[model samples]
Target: MTISESPHEEEPLVASIDVGTTSSRVILFNKLGQEVSKHQIEYSTSASKQKFASGGARRFSVDSAGGGSAGSAGSAGSGAASPSAARQAQQPIFSAEGIAIEANEFLEIEDLERPTNPTLTFPRPGWVECDPVAILAHVVQCFAANLITMDKINGDRVSRSLLPYRVRCVGIANMRETTLVWSKATGKPIVDYGIVWNDTRTTGIVTEKRNSTPQALQDSLRAKTGLPLYSTYFSCSKLRWLLDNEPAVSEAYEQGDLMFGTVDVWLLYHLTANHAFVSDVTNASRTGFMNLDTLDYDDELLKYWNISRDKINLPKIVSSSQYYGDFTVPQCIKPNLTSVAWTLLTDFCSRSPPVPIQGCLGDQSASLVGQMAFKPGAAKCTYGTGCFLLYNTGTKKLISSHGALTTFGYWFPHLENPEHSQPHFALEGSVAVAGAVVQWLRDNLRLIPKAEDIGPLASRVADSGGVVFVPAFSGLFAPYWDASARATIMGMSQHTTASHLARAAVEGVCFQARAILKAMSSDAAGEGQKDRDFLEEVVDETYEKSPLSVLAVDGGMSKSKEVMQIQADILGPCVKVRTSTTSECTALGAAIAAAMAYEKREDRVLWEDLKDVKKWIRYGGVEQGAKSQDGSAPSKSCTYKSQSLDTDRRRKWRLWEAAIDRCKGWMDIVEEGTGAASNSAVKSM
Candidate 1:
């Protein structure tokens, strides 16, 4: 991903912030949704810039009540949207030790922002833990980098007027289920590490929760929350794990000082300086607490998880395309910019929050929207650290009988007619490990020199040559949600070579996608039959959805021609992702949502194209961009229109299922190899 600065131009641009598993990225997009300029700082690649994290010298915006405007050094932005922006919001200002809790008395803001190589740490073989502080720090640095770029691009315009911030709006997309708990009193982490979405630490916890709950209640939870009680991937399991295991967190929880949030909530809370504490529908769906139908937190689900909203500051759930809060600059980093640029930013923050963070979506949902999968039957699959397949379900929620998840596609509430505003839903399938298997071959097996080399190496082999690689490193997820499963390679023989292993590794990902697509087809087919009557009555084209006909694909693994080809050949429908579309889809989706929200808030469409949902989703408005999807634009996408014969596909499917059976209940063996990643975080701090 060329997340590097591009030549500046004179146009209003929206900004997208993506906080992923290993890195944080910020990209600027014009009204056309084309990348204008970008900056990325992988946690492992950057050094600590604590000075900027604290906005320099542990500075606090004391509010207008403190004898200064929101822009004053001792105060922060006090807009109605920003809680910390006002003096009253900053109550109980003293630390437990009686010192005013401006900075040092609370979290080690400097140490927390420190960079560490190999950002994610393995606490146990199957357990993954990441420093929550480090995550926040690295993201702050990412924002600082982008703010500097903004100064460069608009430096000339700034001298004339700061009336309109060139960076018009902000959108956030994050690893949805990674969970964190911190203190509201001091705003410090209750635990040493955050339980990442892919972390398997909650396996035992989930099993216990399932065993204790009655079958009917379990079924009810699944039906409402759209997440299985036994799934370890959701945030509920993480929050439960801490409550049951971590004494400090338990104590904090009981004391009413604890707060739980996914990465999105955490980002919203801190970025807004404690002003906005909420999650969009997409992120909230993964929290395992929100009701799938109502798009609000379910009381039963909360009671089941033992999460007392009164005690713990659970983030309020909101729509994906709505103004949740304004973004106050993280004055912690003094970016390498001129005094004039810094002054301009200071001025912007003072006049009001620099930008309104009006949009947010889970990464996968953002990808789905970015792919313009607006109508039912439209679907998108993201092949990132893991693979996620999401199928749009329109306003209807089709509870998946298969292992796929029923979640939000995106929530765009009506601006003029609140009743007209409704959520678009999706059925999702998850593969716990995808690109990581390729990384395994590169870093662990040393079978390939680089990640990109795997594609070429795999292309050398005709097929897996009877080998089947089950990349259930932390157990299987979606369509076969087995947390006890372990990684296994079956059917290997003396004829096997590194190339063959490469082929198997890449095919493994495709095979998983095939499984999900098959399951989704089954689930969606049933819904199609059930909704025939509904479809007959509906006039809107958005409601016309069935099983995914053409699967849109993206992410790092999608770049591998061989991988894409194998995926295309296996799935019934075609696989397509545009050349400039893979890496940028998630960010672009967030940008679109932001623009949509801005349009609604302003009570007018931004451009003629945006007046139509189809055209708006297609072109991201009328602004012509380098990303034009017209016939003239060259396509790097690979498509396999014809599926392999049913007999052959069945044979491969059987082989994959058999391999999955062989790896069940092997987490115990895997646990011995992984060390605590939190320990490294502690040392860095």
Candidate 2:
């Protein structure tokens, strides 16, 4: 049966909570994909020494290698005998002492401009961590703030007697592979800090596993997990590290009180009042333990890690767009601190019932859904702290011959039969450092006061002035999964200025995205499907005419027209970069998944009605000079057609490529020496 043409319906408003790597947000969207209200809280990673009540002080030391400190926090200590040593002595260590749990209202999205939230603390090189409980508290706070904002907006339209808009469902989109282990009974974190996705401390764990396992076994693992054996990007390696290094974690596991989860599961568990402990297929795909084919934890992979399934609590895998559980307001939010929004939300829930969390997706997959890139070969690039380039491969799970990960895109249970749903798949290329380079520029180099100043500073220079910044700070991901790679700025001359460095940093992000796109295209070509002809057509149209294959972009960095234009240029004339008019596409995607599931639940006829591939053609109406709802199309995106001749682009890309090569093998070379200077050089690079 066909569904109605109107985008709006009686379906209630849906909310999405996006727990990102660098920040957390709660956004509410209507049926037509318009955001009603949003609240955001920014946070960062840290590498500080900690003293536990049970365990004594644990020191995290980074042997200073040389030139300067490696991270943004250490850039000021450049003149010291050893930058790492100097910074280490001055760095504030977060102790388990005097830690208090308090609920801070999530600020409106506009408040994000006030000042940068100091989230990440780099106490030592290659160590990135966050307080998991603090992160969860921020998520709750954002939801409360969003509800308050909604009430303020609704109160203006409706009488005080009437209730504000009700949230019928919630969808969660979270940063994947950031591992956390908490107690199943008490819900307290076993470890004080969460090992962030970009943390490379587990490189030794990955190396040990790879070395211990036979070549054939490693090959089998790659075949099963659809990931290479080198990098520490997955959860299993992080979990392994925790199991070996943290006595608390090991003891908890032995006592059978340990529960493991990626960020999504942690959020879901808290939101549902510890009743629902589950993960969606999209989040499960990145764990490095799930079998790509079976969509379940692989026995052999678990055996390799020496972790028994019964020993620890693992989240149950569920469909991405199905009702998981209901949300319960935590006791921490006292009425005295509650805003009108919270009161309105609680009143609505009391009158009706708690809304179900109907959908969930890993952040990158949700971005793809947000862009409506449902067709095979359709792609997107999200520029957050790191860049994630995802190409939808539709129903087929084409394993990447290249380094890209084969991941579950999304899964919505069939309305009539929940057991028979097929999951969509995508090819993902993760760039370890994207917008984080800008953070380094602002915090470490003191080049710009804010990240937004990057574009203006970069625009002051016509080009990078031969400078190329390869931001492999935590090492390169995808295609080249080198954990030992370090950040490098090459081609600098006496003429180089801050402007040149800023421009180079932006270009570095763009160039890396281009490399991933190239790899994605190559992988798509290798698929040997009918979609190849469509891809060929898109490529042909891009070069011959103005319409290139469109790349729907989102995230903080996508706001920079200069960066987006650079992305278009580096991707060649065949690729058109399109940024969402609304910055909340990631949240909106999660909302869309929830809304779709809600509609399906209400009417089976509407379940897959929107699945028609043609519907996505309207995505980014800015393409081909298409006018938006208003007479003139809004400057939603600043599409920069390839202005440089092919030769010039190639020559520039080659220089950048050379810089990447130079950045490699530095980690290996430094590890051979035990000197503080060598350690400092590695950290400072």
Candidate 3:
């Protein structure tokens, strides 16, 4: 399928925002996957050692008798406030004392001036947290900044004299499993900071629950949640930690004013001006609360977690590519931009109707869509701070025995029954440290001047020179599920230089990814009759009977040729690495989802003109085989075939596996030492 130019005019553009761990990005994509304009805002993740009051500490008493314009400005109304109003009323007014409590029902001018991006804090080692209000502010700031920039670039096209270049919809892709709980009445977070996805502070909570819970019940949880109770990498344990430790969160829960959400839901609620409290299935599935088979919150899982259904307001689960709600630019961020740009954007938004937030996905799922890995057995590896390799398992939610996650790929809104759409499932292998290893080398070790320098520095070395580095900084995720595993570098000698260590770091990431691929292949092979046959066919068709045959790669880390080469070399000859031509796959994936939903819902003339456009945009479509607009066949991807000798590769892999085994139980040793200390203290007492 190809994009056919419309004789009339260009269609309204689609926009997507990717809220990542380290940075947030906004991108505008035409229907054909070409980037029009993009903007990114980078933020620090280093934890501040200070504590601040929760947003809810700021209380306001509303005067129901006074008639005010706060109603028109989207404030929660007087009297018994609506759910949305209650949330709005809870928004904190930032002040010198941290966040100030106000008596007024409406926001004062000073409240709008407070910055949204809060510094991530680490109160203790291995614990990572961030302020939810600050995160909300970052989202709003990115949108306003990007929209203002986009409008300036295309302002002429959106003139009153011409057909306006309306933004048909916005799509969101966010880091998954980062959990937050807020007040239903005031919409303020019960705690000052959200528990980030990678935070391991709740490891003890998960361990205690597993030890106390019945074996039969634990088995049932695995069946229902498609996740193990062994790791704190998910939302369940994080939420549990909050309820047990934070008085504010527990108090709100007891009062029936708590609402739980992943980052996607939090952004959606604020973006729609608090009207929508929903989460797409892709993001919801990662929370460990939603059932894989039912695609909804599981009562059994809730009971297992000791969470009451009535106490916390869970987001309504929706399809990934549906009209979630309309987004109005919040007034708070207007002051941050230049006066001219703000004026133009405000005027433009006033002239144009609010756009729908039509698409939402967890970052990994969005990358899968963006990579166009639509077919069963199709796979993509996103190399971000951590690497995520997702293998499309099609419709079936195949449980993984090899420790890989069985996750929702996406849920497309079916025309006849939009709400109850069937979801696609994927087998995911999450590496806790991929690009982060490179960052460690740069920041902690000072091996390289900058992150990009790793590639060149590592290229100076022929190989790791027998050095093997296992980056388990936040412990191992996927396949191993080892929270106690710590970073280990084995077989290092005096001859080992910075170059060798750098090379080893890159190889470590590749080795981890290869392990995940092997696990996925094993899980697929273990499937039932129908899936086994399907898997066989997929292997024959896509990989010529070889497992781990094809991989689509993207993200900042994939830009390193040394890394890609090592990845290809480590996986052996049968495996092929295909890097995405465009690095913006995550954002593009969201754009594609939004465009598809808009086409189905609106059925515009422009879409009708391109009726033959591929039902799903596959990664490298324009390059691999798809026809371009000018009727030319585009070039294929930059593919790398494995160059390592089979015997040597096997030997290296065995050594790597051995090194990983040595790293195991390292955390257990630390725990034992702590336990011994506690026992001695008790005896002394």
Who wins the lDDT comparison? 3
Question: Model 2: how far is 67 from its true place, Å?
Answer: 32
Which runs of model 1 end up more than 4 angstroms from their true locations? 1-10, 45-119, 155-165, 330-344, 351-354, 415-420, 528-546, 573-582, 599-638, 643-646, 667-685
**Shift of residue 434 alpha carbon in model 1, Å:** 1.0
Which has the higher lDDT value, candidate number 1 or candidate number 2?
Answer: 2
* lDDT (C-alpha, whole model) for all candidates: 0.66, 0.68, 0.70
Question: How high is the lDDT of residue 339 in model 3?
Answer: 56
lDDT per residue as tens, model 2, 1-685: 2133232333346789887765677888764456777765444222211222234322211111001111211111121223333333443221111011111232211111113222444546777676676566566656665665675667774664543465767889988999999998788898777887877888888888777888888777888887776688889889989999999999999999999999889888877744689999899878888988888898888888888898989999888877677776655433213354356446645543557787899989998888777666688888876788988776777677667878888886653433224688888898888767876776567687556778888989878899998988888888677787898989899999999999999898888888777777777765454745445533322222322278888877888887777777777887788887567778877876775665354432112334421132233324445566766754444555666578878889889878878888788878776577778889998
lDDT of 1 by residue, 1-685 (tens): 1112221323557789887775567788765556666655333211122323445322211100001111111111111222232322232221111122221111111122333323455546667666666565555544544565565556756677743336667789988889899998877788868887877777777888877888988778899988767988899888988998999999998899898888888788877744688999999999899998787888888888888878788888898987776666555433423344346455655543246788899999998878777767677888877888898777778888878888998987644443225788888999877777776675557676556777788889777888999888777888888787878899989999998888888778888887787676667666554673323232222211322457788787777777777776666333343333436899988887776684434332232222343344344443333455564423334554534575776687788888878887776555633445556667899
Candidate 2 has a TM-score of 0.81
Per-residue lDDT tens digits of candidate 3, residues 184-260? 89777777789988888888888898789889888778877777776888999899889999999999999999999
Quote the lDDT for 659 in model 2. 84
The global Cα lDDT (0 to 1) of model 3 is: 0.70
Cα deviation of 150 in candidate 3 (Å)?
Answer: 2.5
Off by over 4 Å in 2: 1-11, 44-123, 159-164, 332-348, 415-421, 529-548, 599-638, 675-685
TM per candidate comes to 0.78, 0.81, 0.83
